[model samples]
Target: MSSEIAKYVSECFIKPKYEVQEAKQPYYLAPMDLGMLFAHYIQQGLLFAKPSNLGDEQFSIHKLLQSLKDSLSLTLVHFYPLAGQLTSLMDEAGQKCLVYVDCNKGPGARFIHATLDMTISDILLPTDVPEVVQSFFDHEGAVNYDGHYMSLLTIKVTELLDGVFIGCSMNHALGDGTSYWHFWNVWSEIHRAKAGESVPVSRMPIHNRWFPDGYGPAIYLPLIQPDDFISLQEKPDQLRVRIFHFSSDSIAKLKAKANEEHNHNNTSSEISSFQALSALYWRSIIRALNLAHDQVTNCRLTTNNRHRLNPPLPQEYFGNCIGALKTTTTVGELLEHNLGWAASLLHQSVTNYGDKVVRDFIHRWLHSPAVFKLDVLTDCYSVMMGSSPRFDMYGNEFGLGKAVAVRRGYANKFVGKVTSYPGVEGGGSVDLEICLPPHSMEALESDEDFMNVVSLPLKG
Candidate 1:
């Protein structure tokens, strides 16, 4: 074993805690035709790291799969031939299912292998990107596919080719970004446990049938018509995802200036450092589009609903425990203000999605026959989310070293993908990654004012 692997062995060990919740059958309440939407995403498995050098002894995926054989099961959830219902599963009950393949197994390794027998591009990775320790961000693979919700890039890690790209392809029904990471944590933990290492406790499972009171699924979500359901259409337009880094000093200066400006607006409370950065990007985007600064749009946050809703969900209740915190503003309004002032407006929108409101909203939306699609939030040109603690690149251990690159992507349905990070500086540093139309990206990169704020060095 490599010295790095030795360290993992020396570290303290804790019994693995796997929390299992009854998987609910979502078929009953979910719109029948909506299965097509699920099909769209599930078919495309998430792409994670594509590590090179499968020959590595410690971190090789092939070896890792061998280790997993004793602890996990791989199989498919096949639909019946006659009934055509997803009535039968191919694995033993309570056994976790994962699939492994090579070029000759079936199709190319680029396709995701899942227990459900779905061949979605939901999970895939390109092997060319640099490793986490070298680049810290895989610029090419960290992206969501068209019509899909999240970017799932799978990188292969082997001694011969030592690069790894890690990511997931998740459906909105399974949960938002928060739930996606939660699942990763568990997968990692289980892998570690089987390797004779210790992992933190796992979160509880959410049965597919489980339904909370509120909304029934509105109009079929995947937007598939009756005839279109059976036959898939051409691949939807793809969303472009990119990652950009910023420095701590630059973020602080921007926040200070924003605060000074907010004082003029008669706002007493301070805005978060994130709000300050968001305002700048918002303006840059507007400038890129040549749209009026005052054009009204919404900025959404994926609020953690674990604590807010009625009968707070258990810490183990791991699924899509998230709802959007929406804020409406004009490009002019956001650009006209400083960070502090912009932050206040952003905060107000977030505060609106409290426990009571979120529960009620979920109940109402799910109960309605017409499913509320992305259109409600997409009308606005941009949607931004910030302060994700779960995106901890340093914590993930594929054994080479820390991840060199970590970034977000656009899901194609929306025009924008903006995510901010706490700065590397001890004080308050922020990093923002925005995915926009290729033309919009070019326009923003050229803006003098936008460049002034974001100008910073790479984290390492």
Candidate 2:
């Protein structure tokens, strides 16, 4: 832990409130779950301003910690799979065929409590995100494959002088963003309820992982030793991150501009807010790079496949159900075209990736199960967008006041990975958290076409 972020106090494993045997056999992960094998853990945190009318000396961190840990135990009972560990499942030949979550008395989730010396404004000033935020999460650089031996869930409650940051680090292989937030919602609900009252959540984990049609639940990947993934992790880079806000009005204008310019061709459907904004960023980034006319560029998005499947998987499905969609083009093609053109490319790719496409990708992966590392990075200059704006990032109150802001801990960060969150002001607004090298970030900050639509002035 970084001393600048917090002073380490204590750590303990929080077990389920009651004994549970949800599955007699191991919870075998489906094909989609295995796709994230080498991806970094999903680390995010929420910031809450200190309780009003109370001084730092009056607030007791010990009491709040006890309450949160107690409710977390109850939450684990319902989300039992989170308390489990990912382990290898072997056949009679003693060869590793698949990895499954061992739910039978597995080690529990880790709870860490630390205290820092900073005010809430020190974090929410909208400058380049504070470096100390990375230290708020446990397993800061761990990959999903580490879930084989590491605890699948870790919550670090860092007490600040004028606020608190509740950070969560979950194995990306265990669930997608949807499932991760679902667990957070339940845990916060239990803690928010009246003392000793049983809580009934509107949504609960289905516990069963889904696979494509005609395929069994378990997909095998023989001999997945951790040593094989050491070289697969993201190499360190000199990067800077900043959250840029986009007002709802600006979003609407972008969508309108894209549609008016490109939709007249009658070649594609109307451009959405996400598609339009993504296009704007893509074009701005390409223009900033000053690439050659023939330089190849790609835009990758982690699109949710839940509603794209033919029959569609249930929204409540517990495991990952996402597919990565990539749009490829030359720098000249991307930069010479209007924003609408770039948006259409992204929109078309997303529109084309439907049921048959998803099933076909899964079928191909069934033959060779590999982690989502950098197998394709060498081919092109690329960027990625993830963490949807639809996630209810500010709604988890957890007995504290509503979150003043939401942030990502240092995990899974690469130079062009942009994370989108609903803006603090709500009303369909968005905040894009972009990570880029200092030189690229400098270019982006000065790019007039990109800065024109930003709702607020850039800081730092």
TM-scores for every candidate against the unseen true structure: 0.63, 0.94
- The positional error of residue 195 in candidate 1, measured at the CA in angstroms, is 4.3
Model 1 agreement with the true structure over 203-307: per-residue lDDT tens digits: 534423324554343222222233433322232344344445556678678778877877787867776666676766766676676777557876777566777
Backbone clash total, candidate 1: 85
Candidate 2, after superposition: displacement of residue 206 in Å?
1.1
**In every candidate, how many clashes are there?**
85, 0
How do the residues 1-460 of candidate 2 rate in per-residue lDDT, one tens digit apiece?
A: 2246677889999888887767446788888888788888899989887775445546667878998988998888888878888887677786656788887546689999998888777777736998889888988668888887888999999998888899999998889998888888888888888455457878877876677667777777867777877865654577788999999999999999999888767765789999999999888876766678798889988888889998887777888988779999999899888998899999889879999999889888887776656555423266788898898888898667788888988787776778888888788899999887788889999998999989972232
Candidate 2 TM-score to native: 0.94
lDDT: which candidate is best? 2
Judge candidate 2 against the unseen true structure and give its global Cα lDDT, from 0 to 1. Answer: 0.82
